[model samples]
Target: MKSAVEILSALAEPTRLAAMRLLWDGREHCVCELMRELGASQSRMSRHMSVLRNAGLVVDRRDAQWVRYRIAPDLSAETFALLEAALALSGKPQRVAA
Candidate 1:
């Protein structure tokens, strides 16, 4: 479990917040996909993902040469609710996997 401060701090960045919102639609995203979607460099996206992972907000899995990320399944209701609130504020469309 992560402290609320830790989670909030991780989400405070625009890139990290955007990444979390992308995962909110219940789909795992590969680093490449995220980089393309965010128009961020690989190093920037990876660093943002690393922050989310360290905050326990997201989990990563190895899939061949790709590293995919999703919201942590074990998140507490409070934490999830916080993320939901953030998503609401973001006003971004839900991502649908194709």
Candidate 2:
């Protein structure tokens, strides 16, 4: 059983939540694009991405040197609803600041 704390912790950070919003808006985003928009170091963004991935809330696919991350489609209904509602609350703003 997944801990609620673990899931909430992964969503707690503003940057991580923003990243999810971005992906939720675009469906997928390459690492460079994420870094540019989030103004976060590659390693930093990757760390959050890894956390999301580990929580089974996100999915990634590699295309050449680019890796794209997005909300995972295979999650349980509960998580999917949570993510959808969170993203909805996050709203559809333009690309984030660099």
**Candidate with the greatest lDDT versus the true structure:** 1
lDDT for each residue of candidate 1 in 1-98, tens digit (9 for 90 to 100): 78888988998898999888778888889999999988999888989999999999999998998799998989898888777777677786644532
What tens digits encode model 2's per-residue C-alpha lDDT throughout 11-76? 878898988878775467898999999999999999989999988888899999888987676777
What candidate 2 gets wrong by more than 4 Å, as runs, is: 88-98
Candidate 2 clash pair list? none
Candidate 1, residue 24: CA error in Å? 1.0
